[model samples]
Target: MANLCVAGGTGQVGRDVVRLALDAGHTVSVLSRHAPQAGSEKHHDGATYFAGDVTTGAGLEAAVAGADVVIDCLEGQFGKARKRFADGGVRLLEAADRAGVRKAVVLSIINCDRSTAAYYASKSAKERVYQESPLETVAVRATQFHSLPVAVFQAGAGVGLIPVFKGARFQPISPLDAAAAVLEAALEPGSSEDHRIRTVGGPEVLGMREMAVMWKSVTGARGRVVELPLPGAMGRYLRAGLNLAPGHAWGRETFVSWLEKRRETL
Candidate 1:
């Protein structure tokens, strides 16, 4: 079994990666700001937790020591996003290279380079860091998560109406599905030396308006979806379907299916 270290393993998608990696029988280590105690979530799953912060390079070398593969699921937003996502990645790669780690993997947003949004631009920078780093690495780009649109709609609920972008296209995959894709990238033979970008997305491409309606139906949200044509460079990019990966829709989870599954769990 390989020694796999997950940076930011305590996050929503990162947790899923750690779980799946553990299930695959790899010696899993979680690098987070706070190492969980014996009974905590990170420790309970048979993963060794290491305290580390990639942004400032604190404790990273120790966490990355002897790692065969390091999967980065770090996230951030706005101006800070570039630092946390891109700069942090550089720091992590430096540590991984010094520790003699063989392979590295980083997760990024699909078509982030084509978008003008601050967050997407930051993600694009992060992808570039992996591309330029000498450490064997792959940048896997995934479409938006299922929870993203739901959060947008929920946030838009005001005066019994949900306002959403009229033509925004999204191929929202489940977070777990994205995590599985990342694991596949990590385990692929000789994939570490391949620096090409790999894209993965959901089974279906749905508009923002349609996703908003589904969110209302699933959560029984008391609001009607109001489609508004977003006018901006960012909106133009989204409305053009740049976010949808038509050639790489490898995920099986649909928006409605994911919602139904969650409903059963509740």
Candidate 2:
């Protein structure tokens, strides 16, 4: 096990990284705006929560001080997601380098091939940081989360209408699955200097409409089903090459299967 420092340890995907790293017997430092609440501390004995913000560079030197690897998942919302994703990571990289850390991995979105999509663009920019960096870097891009469809359907529940992308396809994975990959990559040395990317996707791909109906039925969300054709030919290709890697790694939970397990809980 390695000494691992995780930024954004409180975010959705970051939570999984903290949990998995701790469970794997690695010493963990989870950086958050504040310490974990009392209840949140019980599951991971290996995890130490450090109060820090990627933007401020607070508490980061200590967090990365003795770390063998740093996993960055910090992100922002809207166009802000892009800015913070780029700058926040550069800050962490500086801290890690100063601390003499060896391995670094960052979570990025797919097809962030440049500033194409606001979110993807930001991710792409951050990827560039690692490219120019001397530190060992790996950018593990994951598919849209398996939880997303459920989220979309749930948010639309109050409106009593579900919007479906008729021809759009999604190859989503559980956040845990994605997190596992980032962890694995952090430990495994690779060939590329920055190792620009990799993808972790579900066992199968499904149409967006079918996914919505399955979610609606399972969650018992009564809403009008408004099917919208794929957002344009481009929508079909939104993350066209992302969320997939035929032989890389497959998410244990399929889209509908994860929904089945989450339905009662949501």
Candidate 3:
């Protein structure tokens, strides 16, 4: 089995990648800003954790040393996307190269290069960094996660109103499915000459209104689904379905099914 290191291992997608890597019997190491305390919710039994900061290159050499593959699942806050993704990706790739990593995999958003949104632009920049790296890099671009709408709806539910973009549609994939794709890419046999990009999306695409309604039905959330005009480049991007990949509908879980499963957990 390969020695795999996952950056941002405590995040949503990172958690699943770490779990799947361990289940496959690979030696797993997690590089994060803070190591999980023993018996904490973020701690995984089979994986080792390292305190590392990708942007500043702190603790990175130790974290990546002796690792065969590095899966970059790092994400940045709203105003810090460039620092965390573009600059941080460069640092991470440099460290991985120095440590003789064979392969690198990164999670990205579908159609990120076509959008002017700050976050999407930063993601596209990160992809470029990975593509140019000497390591065999695989970029997995996925559609929105199933949890996004829930977060939006939940925030609005507190005020009894859920806003649905007037003309937007979404094809949201489960983080579990996305993580599976990332792990598969990280473990795939390849050389430094090989660099690939792939896309994955949910099983179905639905209007924002339709998804909002379904969310309310499943959660019994008391809120009026208000249709609002989503302005700006991000809105236009969503309305044009630039965020979708119907041909790459690789995920098996439907939005409703995910909601049902999540409800059971809660």
Candidate 4:
């Protein structure tokens, strides 16, 4: 079994990746700022947790040492998100190289190249790092997670209103599906020098209005569904479906099914 390390394994998608990796029977290690203690998710899932910080290059060497594969699920946001991703990614790659890791798997957002949003721009830049570096890396760019729109709707409902972006389209896949894709990329057999990029998305593409309605129905959230035209270039890009991958609709879960399952846990 390969020794796999998951960076940022405590985050949303990272947690799924860690769980799936453990379930797949791989020896797993997770890097996080706070070391995981006994009875924690990592410990219970049979993963070794290492305290590391990618941005400052602290403890990363130990975290990735002797790892056969490294899956990067690191995330950054806001004005400094771009610099954090670019710099931290380079640092992580450098550490991986020192450890002689065989493969580097990176998770990114789909259609990041087509958007000017700060977060998307950072992710697009990070993808380039894998391409430019000599590390054998494969990037799986996935559509927004199904929880994204749900969160938006829930936040709006907190104030008794749902803001639907006019003309916006979303094809959100389950994080589990995205995690599977990342693991597949890491386990693919090939020369370690090969660099590949794949795109994955949900089975169906729906307008923001449609998704809002679905959220309302599934959660029984009563609120005003206010359709508003989003302003700025970011909004224009979203309205144009620049964040979707229609051709790579490999995700099988529908929003309705995801919502139903989600509500059952609430």
Measured by TM-score, the strongest candidate is: 3
Per-residue lDDT tens digits for candidate 3, residues 171-247, read 99999999999999898878545678989999999988899889988888888999888789889899889989999
Model 2: worst 10 consecutive residues (lDDT sum): 230-239
Query: Which wins on TM-score, candidate 3 or candidate 4?
Result: 3
TM-score between model 2 and native: 0.89
Candidate 2's C-alpha runs over 4 A off are 41-43, 79-81, 190-192, 229-249
Give the Å error, residue 75, model 2.
2.0
Which residues of candidate 3, in runs, are more than 4 Å off? 191-193, 264-266
- TM-score against truth, every candidate: 0.93, 0.89, 0.95, 0.94
Q: Please list the C-alpha lDDT of all candidates, in the order they appear.
A: 0.85, 0.76, 0.90, 0.86
lDDT of 1 by residue, 35-72 (tens): 87777665646888889888789999888888999999
Clashing pairs in 1: none
**Model 2 clash number:** 1
Alpha carbon lDDT at 73, candidate 4: 89
| Top candidate by lDDT | 3
Q: Considering only N, C-alpha and C atoms within 3 Å, which residue pairs clash in candidate 4? A: none
lDDT of each residue in 37-99, candidate 4, tens digit only = 787664435888899888899999989988999999888876565568878889999999989
The residue pairs found clashing in candidate 2 are 76-81
Candidate 1, after superposition: displacement of residue 120 in Å?
Answer: 1.0
Clashes of 4: 0
- Alpha carbon RMSD to native, model 4: 1.8
